[model samples]
Target: MLRLRRPNASLVLRALLVVVLAATSAAANEAEKAPPDLARGARLYSDNCGRCHNARGPAEYSDAHWPLIVTHMRVIAGLPGEQARTIEAFLRASNNPPPPPRRLGRLAAVVPAAGLSGSELIERYGCRGCHVIGDAGGSIGPSLRGLFERRQADWIRVQIQTPREHNAKTLMPLYGLSDAETSAILEALRAAR
Candidate 1:
């Protein structure tokens, strides 16, 4: 009579296999966990605005200009407040990122706000489709040369926040921005010249 015998497998080998499998599963579980707000913002930015908007530093534009540009992006990009906030955080983190602290100078670094420059915002939002900035840009909109010198900051802020409020025939659309964005855009415009 021939008896069937199971192939010999070491207990240690089986234990190792089980441990490896458990570790892999744990790693996967961690990845599946919810992303932080900044991560969400970065994902949202890549999906919605990264196509046109390039990266920049906080000093690229004044702290005053970040919000206005974001306002326009919020509308044109169709992002929700949570997503917008996340993107804003991501922008601030990337652009106006913190400077390494000085242990001796005791001088605080002036950092730009957490968002894109007005120029970047304009480019990303397709303002270039109509308006022109510096020597290059689009032709569909008005030329934005020395706009800060031509217009008062408050007036410029108002016009940007609500274009229709100033000119009924103006084709520029209202972006409904926060004060911070308006300030940033205006500051950027001031520096553009």
Candidate 2:
């Protein structure tokens, strides 16, 4: 005869936590290995899914649900793995848009990014949405890695000021960065390598 005892709840919870953390770490590691290009992802998502999925907002789906949905859609639409991954990244980012402006009587106030650190400003402006900084970001634009090494400060400044000057069809938004802000962002881009 043999007797079996079930694992205690605490033991089970600890096991579950370990499993969850391991999965999260693995996913993060995989993401860093070859980050998806968000700009391209958005375009692909629109192109492949716009007609059928237009009625549903991405926010309506759970984060965990998207990969599965994208997988199924990929099979149906014959999307390549790279394209599917890009679309997944874009969908994940779009799941939560930035919060609306704070209201003050008749005025709407924005939390200014003027004084944030270079990295913070980069995040605030969503530069990674189009250009890969280090191992992350979209592939729509040139990688910011070795940015300073390749482009002169003046040239980068011009690009920052008027992106269209560099590329006639550039999709980058003009941030109208102040001298200080511009310097900070440039420094950040330089350090991204």
Top candidate, metric TM-score:
2
Off by over 4 Å in 1: 1-112
The residue-by-residue lDDT of candidate 2 on 1-193, one tens digit each, is: 8989988999999999999999978876786687556556655665677656552445667667988999998899888866788778767665643343234332112233445777887776567756778788754456788887888999998887666688865555555555566667777887778
How much lDDT does each candidate structure score? 0.58, 0.69
Return the TM-score for candidate 2, rounded to 2 decimals: 0.43
Q: Per-residue CA lDDT of candidate 1, range 1-193, in tens?
A: 9999875578778888999999878865664474434434444555556556643333454446766777788888677755666566555543432453233222212223565776666554444444556665544356888787677777887787767689765645444555555665667666677
Clashes of each: 12, 0
lDDT of 1 at 184: 59
